[model samples]
Target: MLLNNLTKKFKHWLPLAKSKIEKGASQLENSINNYDPKEIIPSKLIERLNTKLNSLPVYESYYDTLTINVHDYIHQWIINKEQNRKNCLVIKGNCVDNLYNILTSIFSEKSSLSKETIELDYQIFSLENLKQNRRDRLNYLQEKILEIQQQSDKKIILIPDLSYYFSRTIEGLEVLEKLLKLLDEDENKFWIIGCNHWLWLFLVKIYHWDAYIENARDLPLLSQENLQDILLPVLDLVEFDWNDLRRFLVELPNQNEDDHKIISQLQAKYFENLANLSQGCLGTASQLCFYSLRYVKNEETELSNLKINNPQLPDFPSITQSDRYLLFCIGLHGHLNKSDLANILGDDQIYITSQIECLVNLNLIHFLDHQNIAINPLFYSKLTKDLKDNHFLVESD
Candidate 1:
């Protein structure tokens, strides 16, 4: 079901201004802090909610939706393979869509129903550890490609996250060209490559990468319906008492519908705002959903009160242009370690470390692991616009 026009028209797209983000964040914080202790909802319900949320994989539901369309794209290639023998299909995912994980989940039992004996050779190219010697690192992958080339058998090779295989710097660009050349030359080996949207755009501009791929599909932007699909099943386990937002619920289209349908609409709007806030990123939306949940037990009204607080992107802290460039680079690569990020920026490790710490403090970029730092999904919607406004060549998606 679609969100009503009123909700659609009012979808909040926060601006690039640090002050505005900070102000909204502050307001949300105040509202939460001011909640009465006597009105505190039970910890038991909170625990139960946590259990349900933890059970849901990062973006399995959203990825399931993505797979349907992706399979269609793959199916088209399967049918048309003999006509042109064109092999690579690069998928460009919106900056924060967890596109990498989506690619991995494509072969789930539910999606793998096509009785096709496609002996798929899948490789996730993670070049994080090979920073010191990319040339050698690529040699191993190159050998694998060459081996596949020698095989007369038709191969369906999947390389999820092309961003992992190369750095965004000049050296990375040259390496990408070599890798792409190997893939392009072997028409028999149908290659399916997944890449970050911003990185794809950057490559397109630099190398006319789009021309090389010839076949590309961008994952669709998630909507409130999509967000609710992912969330409501989990939300169903806990009774949420959205007292603060009760007044805002619109009348259902028909009075004869279930009287409780109003509750569902309110929940839908709750996720609608969330989808807008997170800009269609399931990971961000999930985190926001979890944090925004608060328990309230108001003596004034006897009700099960699992509250959903309005979530805002944490303040866009004041940052220098250098911070923007560093953040953008991290986005382009999906994630980059301090050394690699510094290498890309041509800055000293000491200087880059300071910037990384400052950004982590500001909730801009966060460490995915001990070594890799990536843009925080929570701030993705605002940050992408921030980068674009600064003319950082950020992807439009």
Candidate 2:
């Protein structure tokens, strides 16, 4: 397929895009020119707001809202714009209070209007808060939706926590379904749920079809196809260079050695695939591969197998889950025991333990006689060699 065809399709909408751009530009200039810091309603703040608003995607069918700063004044500014229009809604405040306020706001609005705003405080899902009680959150969300529907004929609903909700816990998944259920069934009521990257992944994992709905405006029938078209290209844009992969692995929270090893191996396989497929694409291919790698939850062992069978040495430093595991195993004094591994890693034990056992089965690590806990002398020797060679271990005696 010709790539330029896609560009042409985008170009077809240039006139509409131009007008939006001009309006954004005008807003930005006015905000910037009138800049002042002394007042609470300073132009400096508006300038910043304009900067963010200007960067919003020009695609007309989808309504875009900056999910930043749920600060009370900032949310009021958004709601104030909707007060002039009958169709928009704003839902805002602390999570529980936001739910209560959203209910009151929806009830207080004129039901005769074709549309109304429901601005939410979106912050109620702070990691600490959401993990506290999934059931309560889900119940509150369900009630909040009904409360809003009782008040207005709002078709399009904008929820900024799509990203936050999804990533914080599985509870967000319930929130997503409730939000969709709450929306009017009509074509005009497009639900724009803005979520961050990890939450986006959670959405992708559970409701792959819904991601398409997020962008669906025209024909409901082509939601999947349209979503695929939008996602693949955007996914193609997301990638991580080898160097970036290394840095990310290093910084992962409570990162374990086994995780490092696995991630490292996955990164290698991904780049290897990139080398074969990404001839003219360069960084773009690598970036897309990075996104794909992050979602390797489905075929992790297959990826690990790929790394072992066809090792792809990254040009720069990188760690994989396998690398981490290997390091952790290396930390053992004697031959590493499978039973010891199962006891320590507990809930987190990679489901691919059997496959890893295959490595031991292949004589990579020797099992002690009559005891399943011993590491092979040869394997430990190899680990020592690798650590010394890679400077992971310092020479002693």
List the global CA lDDT of all models. 0.65, 0.36
TM-scores, all candidates, are 0.72, 0.25
TM-score of 2: 0.25
lDDT of 2 by residue, 124-144 (tens): 222234422334545556665
Clashing pairs in 1: 39-297, 41-295
lDDT of 1 by residue, 1-397 (tens): 3577446434421122343456457546755876466454465654676567556664555555555654665566677765332567777776555665677656433334244534544444443455533345456566666666677666566676766666766666666777778766665566768887788878877677766677777765678887787777777876657545565555433545564785566676788889888777776786677667666665688654667776656656566676788887888877777777777787657555645665676668766557777777778777877877888874434
Quick one: how many clashes does candidate 1 have? 2
TM-score of 1: 0.72
